[model samples]
Target: MGRNTRKRRSPLATKVIAGAAALAVGGGGLVWANFYASAHESGPSHNRTRSAGAQVATIQCPDVGQKLRKVPRGARAGVDRELAQLDKQITEAYARLASTRQAQSGDASYVQNAILGPLKSKRTAALDRIGTNIRRVGGNTPQGLGRFAECRGMGVDQPDDGNGNAGNGQDGQNGDGQGEDDGQGQNGGQGQDGGQNQGDNGNGAAGPFAEDFVDINDVQPGSRDLENGFAANGEGGSQGSFTAVCGVNENNLFNSDNLIVAPGVDNGAHHTHDYVGNQDNDAFSSDEDLANAETSCQNQGDRSTYYWPVLRLQDGTQEFDAGDLGGGAEGNVGKILKASEAEIKFVGNQRSDVVAMPKFLRIITGDAKAFTNGVANANSSFSCTGFEDRQVTDKYVLCPEGSQVVRTSNFQSCWDGQNIDSANHRDHVAFVQQDGSCPNGFQAIPQLQVRLVYDVPAPTVENGQVQNPYAVDGFPEQLHKPITDHNDFINVMDENLMNEVVDCINSGEDCQ
Candidate 1:
């Protein structure tokens, strides 16, 4: 009992001392926390007060309406920084999109023309090479003897093949198709000169091999006479000199030695002998052939058929006014498909070379007026199906017929206040009559037929090489500007761009 009393009395003091030490330590820690909190929340006194350690610790239950500081001393910045980064990304995206759109929808002809122009020149070069090769081989065909005969007819001396002998009319061997001559004297066997043994083939007639008898080394330099000409071969017979028999096929073929007559009729000189029934060998054989020729010729004429515009005269009928002249002059008769290189040649017997160097040929006196009209006004407008109607100003209307003027009143404005509707804004032309009859040096006509001539870029050269030799054939004439090239040609066709082509043509650079 005495021990229990002694401990109980003293234990209270021990408990009190322990409690005081604990309170002292807790109060000191609280004061340190408050001091740190006050220093951190020093931006402005208007801000809400902070707890002792809540400022640097987790705040599970923050006071209502208290705005938390967005960033701590070392925390990452907020929305503005992120927004800036996002804006940068957005700008980059837009730029990329713009570039992509341009690449996708930009000029097609210009892009294609860059590559195709050189190819066009190469095509001509290939044709020239073919001609050269034909000339080299002599006859229209690759057969050496045929080519030799052809060359001879053209006054081109053919050099003997390397074997030191003029090529025999029959592949080095004689007409008998034999090998080299044997040592059987003048009148040898198959390989021998059979004509020599046959009474010298009557009156010393020159045999087929006679011309070939010249030593190859003795032959002089030959000329390049291989043009696109054809000739026919003559018939063979038991009698007559072998040369005369085989020589029949010397100059009767068509198209650089194409067949035209029956064999043996007159050797090769059969221009008059109608072998295939149709004797007319001007250029084409039949109507179909003529059509093809005409098309090819036209294609070669402008490199772009778009230049030819149909002049529509208001007859209440949708016919093209090709040759409609107010005065009924052949020159002003119908709408002229603007003269193309081939057209110029076909109508005037002029070569493209005359016009190509200057990039244009002078308009014939008769055609000059019509050409001027076409250049001044040709309606070439088009539209897409789904999108707004696009008035195409980049192409021209080609009138296959003559130059006929259409009534100006007939040329109504398709544009009915709809700027984007192509059907409404397509190009239109009206022919104005003079004194309600005809104009100067002309006859009484109903209308003056005009066209919407598109602004097609003309072929050009830079540094002596073709810059845009042919654009319509391909696409996107060239690079630099969307509508113009360095040569000042309106390389693209569009409503706006068509004006450029018209302007250039009006200035006498591209059309006419």
Candidate 2:
């Protein structure tokens, strides 16, 4: 983990070093810093040899130290405008890069020429302009400008370390990936104590799943309570419902490119995921495939792919392992244990009037990038088997002896009823209202909730010392930290099953 003591060369410097031996000295005694040496120099009369070593040219960035001073009021607006333009340019550049794919030639020349090359050049130019504008507004610092340039010039598809820590090339200001400064407080910044027991309305005991334990109070109030079955006549007048169990598809368990987060980059997920049900589920899996793929579900027609980050447990020596499930490879940082059972339940909309979700509908719940942003976007909940009243939001829970640990995720259920997919992957669907009714323009559909139960053993203790506790894989360092785990589902249900589900909801029958 120690920093390398050798002097690090810039990318250009390395290239220069590789070609240094071929440069030639001019008649004026100045060495030409070119990759090729003139052939005429080989003539006997002109064969006077000169050392090929040339000092690497150091590109000097503008000195902006003095620019970080008092500025005129009018300059602020110009600076803001320029910064916004730069941000827009950077975002578009990333989008274009994401659309580029590898060719069959077994070479990445297309990616280099069409993506990374242009991206780096554009980013460098933007950073330079930004630096100049910041200085013009009297708000530039040498260190700040250097960091901005470095991060912006780095390639766009860099991966996170999976420990909630942003890797190099990430803008330090929004390294957590929320990418917006909406003034929401930092996660875990306010509450420190584990037993503070902050409750809904900021009073009384914490609700189930401990809504007060984090800042997710506004995410959707009933998610915790809804873990239990919804009442028959509770909201929008009870509708019919049925639960179909989609078993695990072991061969489909993958660590492929993730289109939701870092799109276009191959294997960008970094962490592995356990996928079930759908046979053709991947970053590039198409609507056509979803409609046709055979499924592992008993219904055979429900081909929806259910996926989540694999869970790993810490062993006796405090090292995390993935057990039998294949993960924690590449740059991933932990081990994992396979869930004994994974269940995907589809609950009919409380509104007895909603229709069926269209085929190939994509639904994403919870923010995968929410780990560092705090628990607001994290929709994960945990509880013990018998002591269900003690549901908590903490990453790792120490269950009592003879108890089982459970992780649950309930996805958004309301749909726009038009588009099967959206550019952002979320605009097509919305959450059901607090009163259990779908929003005006959105239609209510079956809600998908996944539950994984683990019979984790309590940490062994001897002589007042605690041994290994249960830990999930892929996070860096501390095995027990809370994670921003989320889930994604693309409805590949058979047309018949879909029709049946729609009928059940419209009929108000709660059948499992």
Candidate 3:
């Protein structure tokens, strides 16, 4: 595909152009550059008027998975499989949309008829099956799921946070709707021939637009508080920490499988993920499979799995998966950047003591479709080593010389104390509140924070264009936005190791 600059749209066609999307890999909440024309806009009125005729860049579909939260256990496998199908349907539709730009330019309703219309039909069926699956087990089915079948055509510059508001009135970041599943799962069996051309979208343009980046110096020293009330100098409260050594994927263990979110479905993620910790993970891995699998962690007692989307530089390098399903074939192109460091830490709550997480406790922190879903669960933190105080959740940091890209995420630390998994995948755990206290009745668990550092060259913004943009792999509909960064984890830690973590945090001792 060619990388030509897009021509301006005609005013009359503004009525025809429509919507865009994200679900970055991680357990990395997906973050896209959400446009708040009112707050982010600069320059003359002519520029604003010129932008009125925006071209439809991608399709935005309602994340049905985020809505179904109480599926019965008996119906989960069936429901999950159907949800996976929904993701697959959207991927195919996006591929069609990406590959049909020329035809779209000539026909006002080409996208509606050629891509979105058929997509709705497929989604409607899958949603229907979801209801049937739940009802069969005497569970209450989600209502009005059929309403999500219709996907809108989102424009290149228009950033809608699923609501009418653009940018959520908070510098283009606001609210949380549990977001997408960071597009977990990959069909290790699929072809790696870059079967789909997501990079150029058949229009010869790379993504992240020039809007997804901002120089770190320009980002205000953010007020993000990292201190969770641990004793400063041998003080009280749970002050201990457990740092698990999970190498930065020294073993080329890469996949798109997300057992927690979309079990039994192959190639479910549709985007590549770099995995560490549990070595045996895929769409079909059972709890037993994970517990028995090899581990990347130094402690053999921990078989936990940690995975997130791989970061890539848009420097025209095709990785080995370039032609495979989750790689360049799905629009995740470029050279994969290995983490200079992948640090996994488990810390305690400042307000209360920690408890052992149930075996197989599954957690997915951050939202994958936050670009389209809004900031509700947006938890990805991007910063530079020296500029750690200035972290941004929606935009990737354009670090200065001597600085490197850093991605950090704090998984939900408050567990419901009963179920290990929830229907929306979020009901089981809650984030610690501003006061570092868990919600009422929710027990505090060792908060897991995964930090990844990269030495990729910093992207430079010249004349409002990014020269070397780098981003996490994400769903095609959700443009590779930094806000879409997310991460996933499954606790396969043995009972003894789990107890040790709890004791370490409770005893105020930093342990291995």
Every candidate's CA RMSD: 46.2, 21.2, 10.7
Model 3 C-alpha lDDT per residue in residues 1-512, reported as the tens digit of each score: 11001222123212111122232332022122222111122332111221221234556777888888788999999998998888878777766665554455456566677787888889989988999999999988777878988876554443455555654112211111111111212111111222222232211232665567767777677555444322122344478999999898888877766778888776677777888888888877889888888898999999998999989887666466554556655667777898999999998887788899999999998887787676666788889988877877777887888889899988888899998999889998997776677889898899898889999798765444456578888877777878889999999999999999999999989998
lDDT of 2 by residue, 1-512 (tens): 11101222234333211221211111110011221011112221212121221111111111121123333433433443443343334333332322221120123244345544554565567656655654775664345544433222111112244343543223333122212111222211111222121111110010011111122222233445442222223555545666667665445455533434333233334345667777665555556766787776777877877777765443312122111111222112222456667877677656556667787677777554342233334566766666554444443555666777777778877888787755345666877776677778987777777878887755543222233334432211111234455677777777888888767766777544
Overall local distance difference test of candidate 3: 0.69
Where in model 1 is the C-alpha error above 4 Å?
Answer: 1-118, 121-125, 133-283, 286-512
Residue-level lDDT for 378 in candidate 3: 77
Tens-place lDDT digits, model 1, residues 1-512 = 00000111223233211221111121110000110111112221211222121110100110100111122212112212222222222222212221221221233232123322333343334333433444443424122221211100000012233233442111222211122212211211211231112211110111111211111122222321111010011122011110000111122221111111111111111011111112222221322332232221112222211111122111112112111111010001111122121111110001111001111111101011111111222222221222112222221112122321111101211111212111101211112231121123322111111111222232222221221111111000011010110000001111332333334322324332
- Whichever of 1 and 3 has more TM-score, that candidate is 3
lDDT of 2: 0.44
Candidate 2 — worst ten consecutive residues by lDDT sum? Answer: 199-208
Question: Using lDDT as the measure, which candidate wins?
Answer: 3
lDDT of 1 at 24: 14
Query: In order, what lDDT does every prediction score?
Result: 0.17, 0.44, 0.69
